[model samples]
Target: MARRTTDINDIAFGVIRVRMRLHFMLTPKGDRQAVKYFVIGHPRNGTTTLHKLFVANGLNSFHDSRDWQTGRHDAFSDFGQLRPVAGYDRTYPNARFILNFRPLRHYLNSIATHHQKVFSVQNFINEAYRRAEYFAWALDYFKGRDDFIAVNIEAPGAVRAVADFWGFAVKEPPEGLINNVSTRPKLEQNSANIETALAALDLVEEAGRGCLVSRLNGARQTALLAARDTIRCVQ
Candidate 1:
């Protein structure tokens, strides 16, 4: 028979899943609470802004490429909160996840643009290979399970198309924003690019059954503020 087990905290370039295994609820004494949270997505999609918003709301959040490399952050290192809890999900299990989404060509362009700025003009194949490698890493992390929540700050149709193409797309954009439009950035979503992104998302989601907290890309500020409020509410 196939093994029927799920990893506690799994993450990659795409899906993130945390399994909540503890029945005991713990609090950080009095008014303060240590609720762990992570932001999962492409580099430029407002991860920095969200990190600031969480801090502004008095919630503890961390972000950095090194954070992942060193496994200093929960999403990378511990799988879950370093708290004493059984199973991956139950460990620092109270934390939530924020997954940002951007248009395909736009996302690709942003990465390519940044790569070029950092190094030199990159060839299309080089960019694609880098992106594919990132996606593969993400897929490795979210390889089996759900119990993690995701928030998308991109267009749903565009997101779906991209995820379908790339093999990721964990959760369908939430219900309310299904028809919502985002103004964040103007990018021509070519059919081919969309397909690639979608494929990536699908693969990630399959490995991990995560939910989608979709938001209109146009209302980035609103989304940031709302995320801040959410942290505050829990705090």
Candidate 2:
């Protein structure tokens, strides 16, 4: 003989099921806007700086390394990563891409300086030289795609060019390019050594041949001259 009574467990389970259904129904619409664009570039490039600019302009941009590490797929309007994440293009077919670069010499200098403690000098040199090949690969992989834009962050009016590409006016252009290693101490020796090594390998010329840097038109061309001038001033 058992006492007949309402089961509290049954009532709680029913409430949870109803809430779960509501959550799933409301999620897809929000996820649709996630990862609208990817800033595909290497470390010591301007990815972080550009991300700051995008946020300043009221766009929700995130650095994706943390997301990748935590196995989270949360959405954001923009995503910046040090290197291309495999399968992202196939997964996000409609997402746009920004190919960002800097002069190879300067890029190497920045990398060697910033990571001097993290990597051996020989390892640093090897890694810096490899970046050119990586850049070339990325350029060829995305060639002829109207959804991508290559930008040299050191260029003048780069922020303007980015805004134009997106078809949105910025509230204000970024103050200046950020995260330079020029002022970092103990870099002078590394810079000289890296320059000599690059010249010996002709890496700079090789990088220049990459379509991303070689093919520039309209505003990008103007920006190239500005970039050269900026580099000259810095040196």
Candidate 3:
């Protein structure tokens, strides 16, 4: 017999579930507080996997940014707004934030290749350079926070680390059961040569340094910086 789902989070991703579990998850999440979490990561960074992880643990999660408004999602990810959540703690006590980042060269190539499905690109070099700044800034902003964590999505122990941070039961993460993949099982494959793509774009030197911090207004930047400094001093 087929199982039933109560949350809309289970309904929206039905048409084409990418980088997500191909099977339905029916794990019962016991009662818990109303703490909300927002994942900070770009496309192809396994944000979908993380979203499903929360869903598997019984937290109603939304893959889209706007879904948080329906009052259904206890978790939110893939928020394309590219904005900062500086005072989330003040707004919602015990709110959690998570960031997933990767090296710039790989990131540039991954996104460019992902976009190749729709609009052809010479390698999305320009867009990569811009996004690199945002990621870098976000990494620093969320750094050293008590309720925030940053992880390397490609790392073997990445799932364990995130589960630990959230205090989920220590068990093997379920199989990704992806609907499709041309390359990485967790992500859709790209025919572009990783090395050739980076070299062709001439992003060699800029690979190490990137993040998009442009959207931050002066007040937010100052507050984030001050908070980080204070947190450091206390430690």
Candidate 4:
């Protein structure tokens, strides 16, 4: 009927208008503003998983922040090392944000046991504190708003939830779906570093840093020799 045709036209026009508004928000300054979504927050908490979902669903996505700055990316994952870039949302008010996370020990354990970065336990503790700050600020700023979503990728139906959040059809699972889940395995670190790591950890935990820093004492080091009481309990 003519009425039905008119309704369809109106819907199509509305969509176009939205895209036009977004396009006008900023000139194509760099790889940054071209993006419509910024999947941010600490690593190993499903940041990569969320990004893969976006790309698998056919959105042109980039994983690294620097990579995004060099090209026209529609979605930028892991915007900063462990934080969102300043003024991104205000610059692109139309952009959606996803803060992905997992259990605290699980996150810390991943960082502690990372094959490449184990030598820097102090850095792990430092970054954990930073992640907590980001979460505190983000939750306060973005909670209960439709433009922002906090996704626990480890939670049940997380992938489906993300797809639903974006209203995208998942004809196939996102490529690179593996999450590199946390595990318990003993790893060796220098005793001197362990002592310093724990000292810094205690300081952060006292400051009310979240779960990631609270239980680094024995993370998954059950099998290690008693002399090696490092935070290698979870890997």
Per-residue C-alpha lDDT of model 1 across residues 81-187, encoded as one tens digit per residue:
22222222344445444435443344455554444322212233233333333333333334332423333345335334322422333423233233222334433
Ranking by TM-score: 2, 4, 3, 1
Q: Kindly indicate the candidate among 2 and 3 with the higher TM-score.
A: 2
Give lDDT: candidate 4, residue 55. Answer: 72
TM-scores, all candidates, are 0.37, 0.61, 0.58, 0.59
Judged by whole-model lDDT over C-alpha atoms, candidate 3 comes out at 0.51
Where is the poorest 10-residue window by lDDT in model 2?
69-78
Those runs of model 1 whose alpha carbons end farther than 4 Å from true positions after fitting are 1-34, 68-90, 117-147, 155-235
lDDT of each: 0.35, 0.51, 0.51, 0.54
Best by lDDT: 4
Who is ahead in TM-score, 2 or 4?
Answer: 2
Model 3's TM-score against the true structure:
0.58
Give a tens-digit lDDT track for model 2, residues 16-97: 5455445434443334435466676665666766666676666666664332321133223222333333344654556667
Q: Point out the worst 10-residue segment of candidate 4 by lDDT.
A: 226-235
**Reference-based lDDT, residue 215, model 4:** 36
- Candidate 2 lDDT score relative to the true structure: 0.51
Off by over 4 Å in 4: 1-35, 65-67, 79-86, 115-125, 171-176, 181-235
Stretches of candidate 2 off by over 4 Å are 1-35, 68-86, 118-125, 171-177, 180-183, 203-235
